[model samples]
Target: MAQIDTIIASPSPVECRRLQNILEKEPDFRILAQARDLSQTYTATEALSPAIVLISQSFAALPEFEVMHMLFRVLDTRWLVIENGDACTPHLKITRNSDLFTIDLRSGGAGLVPLIRSVTRAQRRKMVPARPVRQSMPGQKKLVMIGASTGGVDALATLLSGFPTDCPPTMIVQHTRHSFGGSLIGLLDRQCAAHVMPAKDRMRLDPGTICIAAGGRAHMQLAISHAPQVRLVPSAPVSGHLPSVDAMFHSALRVAPRTVAVLLTGMGRDGARGMLELRQAGASTLAQDEASSVVYGMPKAAWENGGAQKRIPLVDMAAEILKAASMSGEEAKP
Candidate 1:
């Protein structure tokens, strides 16, 4: 069994000791380090890349907490935050922004162990390879629609890098942090031949430019017209995600005369049903094969739910896209 390493960050030495004691009881967990201050926490995290970071509420008020939070999100590290309360009624807070899970610290910390175990299980799943699969999607693709979540940054970079400067107009929806749209587009722009940028509301969909769904409290959809454009609308979260892939996929079904939908690595089933709808509407659909996904959950869900018409490896996805676009038959070997 693989063991999970952790770093405990607590402003109070007594609270740090208490967490350490509780964690020590689990055979599969190892305490890598403990920090009582911001400086120590920074040094410890840099020196030892722990799987999980247990943070006490005292650290939340400091400016350093913001930096640490960003660092953890970028590194894909799990954080569990213990609320500021005594043993009787401790609460835990978990959110997409904070990337932390809150739990009651009373009852001799019974809930802590299970939470850690669940986190470890998820991490282990990410480490494992996906099984082999084969799928086929045939269409004359005019517009390309893509959806991704975990591992999307790297996957998009690789896929777009193979695209020609004259590639078809492409729209993408990726689950990410607020204000991360610029950074993601910038990163992708550096790696790909096609221009990459954030989608502007009412901006015309142009050939050779890839528009990414803006990250925030809205769903990014397309407006039907002589010249289709991107539109951001405030709405309830669909499939547990704002800017949901499902929303984008379902929208593609409306304008499906010549479109292709591709679903990539992510967790949950947000895009599964929507992809199925696109396929039923005569649009081609593709999904990332398991072996290459950082998390196979989303693509797996899409494939299993009869949403994906083709399952392709990450290395070959770009070639496949170009092939579907009728750009070149010579590059279809992947």
Candidate 2:
């Protein structure tokens, strides 16, 4: 594993020291500098050039808009913000009900473990080489399904933007807070070339579209009858997530048996079992390799459970999916 250099910034001196001490104990991580305030943070980050920056919510006091702007400008690095109690930070906000806070870091202690894990994971992504695309064989119908949680907004945007307008019809399971799903879809629609919208109940699957599952009471499933459609399964949560990846993959297995299932960066094992099922059903399955994952737990679980046929970096995923789908189509042609 590559070494991860980090800068710790907190308005409170005690919190800064505490986070620094925790970061120092990790063999893979080095505390490049500690800052007592925003001014010190700017200076330390510029001079140290750390790969990640950990900012305590105290910085949130410096005008929410200004704080976020400054944070983005100073450190073109991955940012993790520590919140006070149940309070959240505008920058690096963890969505409600996401498994981001599941780590057992001490209270008011900056949750060093999750921060370190995020940084380490970011470093891994930076190291993977791009994969070359194989020539398309013929008659292949490529499909892409993605599941994401915690930090998914930016992650999903990054993953989707690489795809062209003619890319495969993609289904996404983004674990979002209630009422936020629609806005997220709108946001993604504007950012990417493909048409992005929330999956509607009983709607026929279409090509060249991106459907996102609703975060409310409904989970998206595939109805296997003629003109296979998206079904809203109002069921219990599996693996602690609603609109679960397990549900999506299971549906894809029945509907598009040969579709490619991709388990992207997320916080847990929600997609692992389903991905394995997809593999068993003769579908090609891929997991976002650890180096490019925002949180490696999901892809790691899929890879460990023998779910992934290929583990590719995030940047190359869109091209790979296109190549694989095109090849599959050619192979199926009479």
Candidate 3:
């Protein structure tokens, strides 16, 4: 297991205790330091070199932008800003301007755990390699498969919104708790002009539509029946995940060998081997760049394994996918 160095900042003792309790639950995480003031937080992060910093809006007297700028400039650590209460604070609102930090209210602490875990998992998965892939053939309809977990809701929203309505038939495996799956789909549908739906078993690939895997009962798979279609399988978790990215990518490669497989911001290497298979099958592959990834695990693993042909930022991924798919004549029209 990989260890995470962490820093916590909160002006109040109660808030500090809450964050401390949360960190204590994760064995792989170590508290490098804690601070209640802006100056102290900046000093501690720079000296400790923590990978992530958890900060509350009430922390210190400094303005939120100053604190955020300092953290980014000094440590380059990922920041998770916890709002003080139900009402959005001015600092919290300002924090949202930067893509580097994730903002959430303290009332949503239950959701925070999963996001932290996802980042931790991503860090661990980044160390893995994607080896033993086959090369792609030229001029084939290229399928692009993507997977994300934890802070993936916002990350996916940011990445997918850039996609045009005519973007290639893209499939996504996003890790969300059961009840939130539909809401997740709804969010994406509203954000992107592209059609987004919960993937159903045996639904044929249609241009300009995005299929997202639903949680709970069914696992999404790519099935070949006359032609390739999204198939929902009732099966146990593979790689500790259902609607596994690996499963989707593996099936996509089998159905369309010369596809593009992308492993985006997520925790764990669920799609590492599948990405390798796609590479071996002569498919173009990409990983999300580390700087832009909330957690760089999945993409890093794919890159290390020699599976990724390119590593791009989240903002640019849709365009890159379109470019790659166009080479295979599967380009969606504008």
C-alpha positional error of residue 193 in candidate 3 after TM-score superposition, expressed in Å: 1.3
Candidate 2 stretches with Cα past 4 Å from truth are 1-140, 329-334
TM-score of 2: 0.60
- What lDDT score goes with residue 50 in model 2? 73
Alpha carbon lDDT at 16, candidate 3: 78
lDDT of 1 by residue, 1-334 (tens): 6888999988887778889888887788999998987557756875686788888766654422544564464456688777657432111121233456776565556688889778757752232221112122243347888998866766786788777766778889888766556656665665566778787788888777789874667787878798878888889999998989899888877766467789988778888999889877777778999988867888999899887878999999987776766522222222
Report RMSD for candidate 3. 16.0
Worst 10 residues of 1 by lDDT: 87-96
Over 4 Å off in model 3, which ranges?
1-140, 329-334
Q: For model 3, what is the error of residue 67's alpha carbon versus the real structure, in angstroms, after optimal superposition?
A: 25
Per-residue lDDT of candidate 3, residues 258-318 (tens digit): 4777888777888888888877776778888998876678888888888787889888887
Model 2: lDDT to the true structure: 0.67
TM-score, each model? 0.59, 0.60, 0.58
